[model samples]
Target: MFYGVSALGRKWSNRSPEEHVRRWGRIAYGVSILGFASHVTFFITRWIGGGHIPTSNMYEFMTFLAMAIMFAFIVVNAIYRKPLLGLFTLPLTVIIVAYAAVFPQEVQPLIPALQSIWLKVHVTTAATGEAFFAVGFAAGLMYLLRTVDFKKTSPQARREQRWVEFTLFVIVVIIAFIGSVFSFRGAGYEATFKQENVVIDDKGIESTTTETVEYSLPPIFKPFNSQDVLVEPFLGVKKPLMETPSWMKGVNAARKLNTITWSIINGAILYGLLRLVLRKRIGAAIHPLMDGIDEDDIDEISYRAIAIGYPIFMLGALIFAMIWAYIAWSRFWGWDPKEVWALITWLYYTAYLHLRLSRGWHGSKSAWLAVIGFVVVMFTLIGVNLVLVGLHSYAGV
Candidate 1:
């Protein structure tokens, strides 16, 4: 399908600007949708099959991050009809999903620490806000690309510059997403290893496929049939697999509740997607597509997304974090490196909004601020998770 689209784009490139844009739109939309669908299936299956919330590890976190950003773009494009933006947004999604591909695909049980209902509300809302930032960042790039002038330069030169900018944007997006995912999911999963050796018993050398060697098996059995430590002669069978920890039971219950909440949220997303695609109001739809985007509207959308997202991020990073810390570690707002980065992230966005509104910034300047704000948001969201060490350092990226 991409081949056919690429062929069509080549055929149309020399035709006219309108045809060129139409061709790009079709191809970008196709690729972005394919990425979106793959993300949905992978994460949803992980959620259901694992009987856990979807943000448990790097693989799952990346999957969710990609989906959230794609969802935001889909929403924006459906309403704005700014398909050129997909040239920015869709490629970004592709990159994140590509990164996720490097991680293992098997489902793993959620650890006790991550097993909280607050995780679903806290993580999803935080991620959803980041998704909006993804769209805002794309819009900011579009504003920049369109506003930049290189009339004296050759068309090839201008095209190359645009490509470079787009590539940089993708790299930044990847850094931001991974960092944010890390902050929540932490540095990675705690790994426990196991070994096996055959032993003669009443059941005679019990053999099993590697597939049946469950990680969830008892810790004692994890070592396997060893002669080093002699067992009591009266022992008939190996110790039974340990029951799920009492602390984990609540987490499991929270997961069940989270699944229901996710269902409702997904339904809302589907409805928003429908309205965004079909609605064609003048300022909201036609203008952005026709190169008629009102600076006010662009400003408004960026403002709304950042305004809503930044605070939510702060809450996730700071407030809920404080509670989780106090519960687990008897500290609430430790000046951990991750916490410090979160504060830096918040300060960064706050400065952005300040420069935009109080300072009366607009156009390219405001767009640049929006771009920078999201960069901070992304870093806070994914970068800190991957690069910096901190209390909330679970990103496993």
Candidate 2:
């Protein structure tokens, strides 16, 4: 692996440094394709062995995340011919895939909530969109690095010689923040409830007959309080909460939901740990890295990523989400926390697009907006899944 990376680096270094970057970009594209194949193999194995969707839980979800990001990277590199960008993106892909190393192999039966065909479409589409955003992030980082003046030997330059390095460091910090929050959230990040129909002994089935609170209780801390646990009156309950059907008495509906929640929480924790340990923020940690880049390249790269990723994000987060919600929950849009956060992410990126195209908005301000837009995307994709609670809060944990 190191040999391939080194060869690509060498190949990329032979050109006007800029042209060399494209050669390395081609190499990155090849490597990511191989990695993506391997990732697919892992998912396929899990699906065959587990006999269910690849994203039924957190481990699978992450497996999908890595695959999606790599897919996006491959597509973008093939079209843009920007290999230097791969230096950032490939490391991230590696870190994401590494999470699978610690992933739990245990597979269980899917709950009713996850039994729809929408499960496959909804989660994978979201992952694919996020993958584009990942590449966009790399583009934005390069944009920032490309803007700094490294040629000057003045006092200010001397004092902040490695400003690009520092900027890279900040980006890593931001990614780390994203990964950590997701991990915590997947660990049963929020409180939720599940309602199920139960059949009575007297030959009648009571719909939404019972309500149970779901939790992502850590395995070591399982079996929590029951008596003092607050129970909200079920607004959608179809039967009386007090006189639940006899079949309802035998089922622990909360546990069913929590099982999925546990997977999501564990997945989030794994993602955070991987990001922290991979030393992924390497380029940003020192001087000399990206010292050969130009300002135009940075601006161009940022524009390309936003143009590509923003629309894809909209298709997945807004368009597809609305379609899926209508099919699954009978509503096109809900004021649920997850829905609200998605809209927030959309607005942030929309503003970014506007700012970039606006006559007075270019250069550093554009770079800043790209950065902010990515931050919003990260929160919407990982933060809301892990930190906030709501109706569409389906991070499995």
Candidate 3:
């Protein structure tokens, strides 16, 4: 809360006298350091108490990611002294910490496969690298808001404008997902479904198994092949409105689909409310705050951040990951969904760097690439883990 308040205070302080802005900046920085110190302390104590590194589970890993992001922010802020950066990164960190709450928080022991020291090195370094990429995303977004010509009616400009709006929409949807999860969770809302799937072997022998799906949020879409075991009514709605398609494959596929449906419905409503309140597109509403910011500097900050992160990401997500993979499964690469997505993320940033340095992809083009790169990173982290069953599936839980 203090971090968020300090960020907003910095925005307002920008219009004040130089002395006042400087004073407020100092206060904001101090609060940021204090918050980061507390975060690190929690991390250390959890490591000691849990008898292992805290990045073994979803909640622990996400909190670690938030800590890494804050650490990255402090470093970048120290170098550039950009108070405005806090306005975006701090809120994102808060949102992540909240999103982390959606998962079960109880500590679970590391499995034999994940018991190696390589797992710890792989997870921590990957998170730290992704933290820098997150900073790049924030800076890239700032560059876009700082430079996009919102008033231009030209086809190209309109395209850029719409993409920016969609970016804001994505952010709003994530926030909505987090908000709705907590709201329903607090209300103790739940629905359970039982799914039966029959498998036929190569010899034509068939077997049936019953699986269950539990939802903390109201089920908007039930499992593909399932019947309701229990559904507590919400606002007189007793049944799910739809069913997940067979194409959506996973043990948790139905629950994931239902959560997505709810998030979209709530996200659209929340985003519409924001539009009505601001009387403009959220991007246009925020564009004014980019005034007086140097676009080149913002672009440079984005590029430099990604540049530093790319190699670290290479070492951790790929190198360390491959080492652990070999240790755990006797293979370096098996084209698992997670591994494939990690490679895709690496190549995407590799392309970004190639275009950036050689093709002179400087300003908005580079910013857009940086922004899109993080989306790939997130899908690799959250989407693949939750939606796909692989060797790394346990991480999703």
Candidate 4:
């Protein structure tokens, strides 16, 4: 409802044949407040029911992300009075909520690693920081759309516009991929695997062992074996033609790779269908709606968001994270993928600040950097946990 109202408000603001745009904007703001209130209620209910903070898994973190985005949007909009900011931020909150819905929602007991007070403080503050960065991303996108000369016929200008559109398309693909995975799971997709190994002891005693693993996505192809193979049909085919490589590290690596392949294929299909229907990139379609917004104000908001978020991000994602790491793992920094990515995110935002403050990079350049910075933030939050195997893997599942 918040998304619908905010979208309608943006549309009416753009083409105000009547003076009802402000009314719609007010309605949208009220709806956002209600949504935020409901989100808080849900979080409190879960925390009470579960006996702890609800930041242990993807579902919980994603919920926090949605709430944080809404909270940040409310604060920024209150300060800037930009109706379009709400219009931009609410859709992202909706997307995060939708993504959270894809994961299992049942509250479970915390694992040994997560049973710490730092879980609440570190994760919540980090999420809040990222939420502010999300606001920066929205403002940056609006700044670029308002300032960029998309009508230019020059090759370099056209290339830059294409890059922006490509980035938008990538976001669409990610959403589609998540949606596809959820649908596939709902439709009862499954995969089976068997492994056999021989072990020789110090006394030269040998033993043979066999193990089986089941997964949610059917393997593209299984390792060649004389033993009977369990095959499940998918899209009227028993299996894909290509086999996952045997060189992958973890036992579940092949399954992960297969799922990723399916996601990419689904993402491509969705992107093609969207391109066919829209006749232009999604970013291009939305560019005109930013018609009257001042580019300078948008740029300043983007800069201010980073300036505000960076310190909090450093404190939570780095300082608090390191403290937690020491307590949890007996190390200040382990170079774990999550830790490395968190550090990378910190450094990226630091560069964003230096570039903006020292080098006077503003308008399109700074805007693009802000957009890219958010992408890094997301990878740190989601990609590191999902694609990479590390101590952080349990946080995602």
Top TM-score prediction, candidate number: 3
| Candidate number with greatest lDDT | 3
Model 3, residue pairs in steric clash: none
Model 4 RMSD in Å is 3.0
Model 2 lDDT per residue over 1-397, tens place: 4323433455355556445554555555676677789878888997898888788665667778878888887777677665666777777776665544344546867777677777777777767877777777777666665555555678865444355455454444544444544555465343344445444666685544545544333222112223224332323432222222333232343343344444455555554565477554333332245556566676677677667767777777778878878887889988887789888887877777776777657776777677666667666755565556676455534
Which runs in model 3 stand beyond 4 Å of their true positions?
1-17
lDDT of 4 by residue, 60-179 (tens): 999998899898888887788777788778878878888888778889899999999999989999999999999999999888777667778799888878888878777676787678
TM-scores, all models, native as reference: 0.58, 0.64, 0.95, 0.89
Q: Model 1, range 146-193, lDDT digits (tens) per residue?
A: 555434277865664554355453454445434433432353422133
Writing each residue's lDDT as its tens digit, candidate 3 over 187-271 gives 9887899998888999999999899888999888898889999999988999998888988776588887788888999999999
Runs in model 4 deviating more than 4 A are 1-18, 196-212, 221-230
Candidates 2 and 4: which is better by TM-score? 4
How far does residue 169 in candidate 3 sit from its true spot (Å)? 0.5
- Per-candidate local distance difference test: 0.59, 0.61, 0.88, 0.81
* Model 3 Cα shift for residue 32 (angstroms): 1.0
In angstroms, the error of model 3 at 50 is: 0.8
Number of the candidate with higher lDDT, 2 or 4: 4
